[model samples]
Target: MIRGIRGATTVTSNEEEEILEVTEELVNEIIAQNSFLPDEVAQVLITVTEDLSATFPAKALRRFEDWTYVPVMCATEIPVPGSLEKCIRILLTVNTTAAQNEINHIYMREAIKLRPDLSSTKRLAQ
Candidate 1:
């Protein structure tokens, strides 16, 4: 089965360092929580809010040793009115035997407010 794990996080600023740092942290938590390997990831779609333009969030995946072959794409999020700023969202598709409900969707930092209904959104200790 193919499962899509949703995750999002916010950066304090639009700096490249902050963007990369938060992106890595978000993806790392998703991988850890789901217990998945990079080879199992079919693709990763990343989107950043209009307020963030320092760098492509996808670049952060390169820092992962085994993620070299994983396909990733990055885009700009739609600038809806009153939308979150300096935010990065990811839709990570992976091949897994686990059911959809078993998948963990992580929302970290200020992005936790984006999906309060998902129990997975409960903030994990930093």
Candidate 2:
């Protein structure tokens, strides 16, 4: 069956390095949490808030060796008046046997406020 995993993270700055660093961290966490195999991933879609334009989050994902075979796309998130800033969100489409409720969705850094219920940042360290 096909499943979609959602994840989000925030960066401190619009610099290319900062954006890439946070993005990589977020991606790694998503993979580890979901136990996702590279081959199992159908596609990855990334969206960044308008405040972050230093680079496309998808560009940073290409630097990973395991992601070379995975197709990734990027877009600008719809800017809502009160939305969080410097946020990068991703949706991964994967083929897996796990049910929807069993899937892990990650939210990290300041983005945690966006979804306190699903945010695992504080829980992991504890």
Candidate 3:
């Protein structure tokens, strides 16, 4: 079965370096927490707030040696009023036998407010 793991993180600035760094961290945490291999990942969809135009978050995924063949796409998030800023979100669809409740969805930094209930599970490295 295919399962989706969701995660989101925020950067202080819209700089390319910040965006890349935090995005990589977010993806790594999702991989680690869920204990999944890169080959199992079917697709990764990344989105950034309208204010963040410095770079494509998907670029960071390529930095992973084993993720070269994984499909990744980036897009802009819907700009709803009062939405979080400088946030990068990812939905990783993977081929896994794990049940939905077994999956860990990570929310870090200010993005934690997006999913307070799950934020209590663990936290992202600062």
Candidate 4:
């Protein structure tokens, strides 16, 4: 079955290095929490806030992982009023047998400020 794993993270700056570091951490954490296998990931869709245009988050993820064959794409998040800034979010479509509740969703860093409840539950360090 196809399952979706969702995650969001925030960065302090739109610099290339900052984008790369935060994106790497976010993607790595999602994969770890969900126990996602490279071959099982159908596709990964990433979105960065409008302020974050220094680099594509998906590109950072690809460089961090060995999944050269996995399909990944990145886009700018819709600029909604009151939306978080310097944020990067991901929706991973994976072929998994796990139920929705069994899948882990991660929100980290200043991204944690966006979801205080979820932050406590997330295991950081990727």
Q: Which residue pairs in candidate 4 have backbone atoms (N, alpha carbon, C) closer than 3 angstroms, thus clashing?
A: none
Taking all chains together, each candidate's TM-score versus the true structure is 0.94, 0.93, 0.94, 0.88
Candidate 4 TM-score, true structure as reference: 0.88
Full-model lDDT, candidate 3 = 0.90
The candidate, 2 or 3, that scores higher on lDDT is: 3
User: Candidate 1 local accuracy as lDDT?
Assistant: 0.90
The alpha-carbon lDDT assigned to residue 97 of candidate 2 equals: 91
TM-score, model 1 to reference: 0.94
lDDT string, candidate 3, 4-100, tens digits: 9999999999899999999999988888889989999999999999999999989999899899899999999999999999999999999998999
- Cα-based lDDT at residue 7, candidate 3: 93
All-Cα superposition RMSD per candidate: 2.1, 1.5, 2.4, 2.6
Comparison by TM-score, 3 against 4, better one: 3
**Pairwise TM-score winner, candidates 2 and 4:** 2
**What TM-score does prediction 3 earn?**
0.94
Q: After superposition, which runs of candidate 2 have C-alpha atoms over 4 Å from their true positions? A: 122-126
Give candidate 1's error at residue 79 in angstroms: 0.7
| Cα lDDT tens digits for candidate 1, 12-48 | 9989999999999998989888999999999999999
